[model samples]
Each structure stands twice: as C-alpha cells, then as structure tokens.
Target: MSDIQIRPVTENDHAAWLPLWQAYLTFYKTELSDAVIASTWARFLDRSEPTNAALAWQDGKAVGMVHFIYHRSNWSIANACYLQDLLVAPEQRGTGVGRLLIEHVYKTAKANGCDKVHWLTHETNATAIQLYERIAERPGYIQFRKMI
Candidate 1:
C-alpha cells in the first residue's frame, strides 16, 4: 500500500495500460474486437468524453487499472458515476491495490459533483465481494438486461 501510486491514465501510457485492460477482459471471459479496444482507449484519452481511466503503479510498474464513466441520472439531480472496469495484477491482489483504485473513484466522483458511484461484479467474484461488502452496502437490486 505504501509503495502503490494511483494516477490518471496519460496519453503516453498506452503500452503500460493495454496489458492490464486485456487481463481484465480475459478475467471476465470476454473478448472484444480490436476496433472496440481502440475506441475505448481513445475515449479514455479524450477530455470531452465522460469516460476516464486510472492506473496503479508500484515500483514503477503498472499493476492495475480502473475505468469509470459519468452520466446523467434521472434519480438524482447530479451526475452519477459508474465504475465500469477495475483490475489488479494477479500477483498484486490482496495487496490493497483494488481498494485504492476504488477509493480513487470515490474521491474523483465527489470532486466531479456526482451524486453516486456504483459498480457491478459477477456473483461468483467472492474476493471482490468481500472488499465491496466492507466498503459499501448491498442495495439488493438485481440486474436484468437483453442484447438487441
């Protein structure tokens, strides 16, 4: 925790950032096309886009990354922040990197005047669930979706 540094993803960080992003998608058993990946990276670097990304570095090595988005919400007057993606290197798990990244989002959301910050995890992600339980309440809202 003491050596970990979490910072915004800069334009020059593409190489350092790609592996972490690919690992995250792999963890979820999802495969995205190169075009989608390119677009997402572009959005992260675009200042006018509501999407943002941050990387966690330790000993000058990038070990984790988190991506979030800000959008208007009908339930709240202020914008809502969604923590869309978060991943820490397998070796870095249990070392507090994930928590630090989440805390970064919390602070960023507040600074941006967002009313809430939320995220979803697969039910089988017990490790993350434990951490989330300690930091947030379970709102008990089940999610349902259909792809067109």
Candidate 2:
C-alpha cells in the first residue's frame, strides 16, 4: 500500500511520460519510430481520439503510466475499454503503482460508459500475471494476432 495518485495525462505530461514510454518499449524489446511516438503523444492529448493515457504519481514524481482505448464491442451495448499499455518505473515496482494505475483505468472506463475493461500481457510476464490474477479473472481466452 503506497500513497500513489493517479490522474489522466495532460498536455504537460509529455516530458514526464516519454521516459516511461521508452522504458516500456525497451522492456518488450521493441522499438518505434520517432514519428510513431509523436503520434501517440498527440493521440493521448486529443479528446477526439479513442486512445488515452494516465499517470501515477508519488512524491511529485511519475511512478507509472497506462494507455487505453475505447471501442465498440459486438457483445455489449456499451463500448469496451482496452488497456493497451502499462508500466511502472523500475524503482517503483511492487509499490502498488501498477495496481493503482489499473484501478484508475477501471474508473475511467466506467465513467465513460464502458461495459468492461480488459488487457493482455505476454505469457512470460509472471510477476505481472501474479498481480493481475489477484485483481482480475482470466476469461480463459487466448489471443492470436497477425501483424501486417
């Protein structure tokens, strides 16, 4: 239990958000173009975009971040919220920052008329899976994707 404050990302958050974003990319062993990063930051600040972000702060420093998207769902009348990205600063891991960020997304989705909030993690991420299992139930669905 840590004193973490979670809030929606603002235009001013770009500077603080970049390192976290890069660290997250590095963790996945993936790289993106500068153009892509710029576009993503823009989307986070654009109210018209389905993509959005939030940050978790502790002692005036950002400790974690989450990015999510809202989209129509075939099974539900309300839109579904897909939590696309989440990261906790290495020094702040295990400090409840990740859970707080997730809870923020859950509240945000509910406030925005989402019927559900869901996310996916790599099968090998055991540490994250442990916390996720405690807070959420796996619907037992396997994900398959084709990158074009």
Candidate 3:
C-alpha cells in the first residue's frame, strides 16, 4: 500500500482536482463543465458551505480525490455524513487509495458528531460495492433524482 496522505481540500488544488472530477463524471457517464467544477470547489473550500469538504492528495505523481458533506435529517439521531464524490485515478485504483479515502471519510464523520456515513454507487460498480459492504450497511432504499 502507498502512503496515502489525506487532508481537506485547499483552493490551490483546483488544477489537481480537475482530472479526478472528470474521471468521476466519466465513471458515471455524466457531462459536467469546468465552471461547474470550479463552483463546487469554491463551495467546498468555503467554511460556511454546508457540504464542501474534500479530501485529496497526490498518489506519487498522480492525484486522488474525495468530497463529502454533513446534513441534518429528521429521521436520524445526528447529522449524516454524505460522501458526495470519491474517485481514484485509474492508475491508482486497487492499490489502497480508495480504501484510504473511505477510511478518512469514516473518521471525519465520527469527528463531526455524525451518526452515520452514507453514499450510493452504481449497482454495476462491483468492486466498490465489495468495499462498501465491508464497512457499511446497505440501506433498503433506492435513490431518485431530478435535474434542477
């Protein structure tokens, strides 16, 4: 396993975050823009922004990224930490980068007084599901979405 350094995203990381964001979009086949990604990065770096914390680092010469947010809910005991985006460059996959990101998220959730950590992945992402199953309970609910 490589020594994965995990930390909160900084403004300067925008250039580094681009490829990972693109990979995440490609992984899901979504077409998003640089401007949108820029805005998202701004929101993440803003301390007052509700859900903008991102974790990122250079895996040697390559970059890996993770973004997450905490949300309050009526049905939950405490705030739920939702992992908004997580992506490891294809070259870095299967070498512990993903696991490090998830572990970092888990620790972040616990530190923030969150009762749980939640995220959804495509049903077809078998490798991710394997890791998630080991660390999280699959909620018996399907996600519904609408473009705003």
- Summarize candidate 1's per-residue lDDT along 1-148 as a digit string, tens digits: 6599999999999999999999999999999999999999999999999999999999889999999999999998999999999998999999899999999999999999997999999999999999999988899999999999
TM-score of each: 0.98, 0.97, 0.89
Candidate 2: C-alpha lDDT: 0.93
After superposing candidate 3, which stretches have Cα over 4 Å from the reference? 56-62
Off by over 4 Å in 1: none
Question: How well is each residue in 1-148 modelled by candidate 2, as lDDT tens digits?
Answer: 5578999899898999999999999999999999999999999888999999999988888889999999999999999999999999988888788888998999999999998999999999998999999999999999998999
Candidate 3 achieves a global lDDT of 0.79
By lDDT, the better pick of 2 and 3 is 2
TM for candidate 3 is: 0.89
- C-alpha lDDT (0 to 100) for residue 139 of candidate 1: 100
Say which prediction, candidate 1 or candidate 3, comes out ahead on TM-score.
Answer: 1
RMSD of each: 0.8, 0.9, 1.8
Cα deviation in Å at residue 127, candidate 1? Answer: 0.4
Q: Write the per-residue lDDT of candidate 3 for residues 6-78, one digit (tens) a residue.
A: 8877777766777778888988999977688668878888888777555546654445788888899899779
User: Which of 1 and 2 is ahead in TM-score?
Assistant: 1
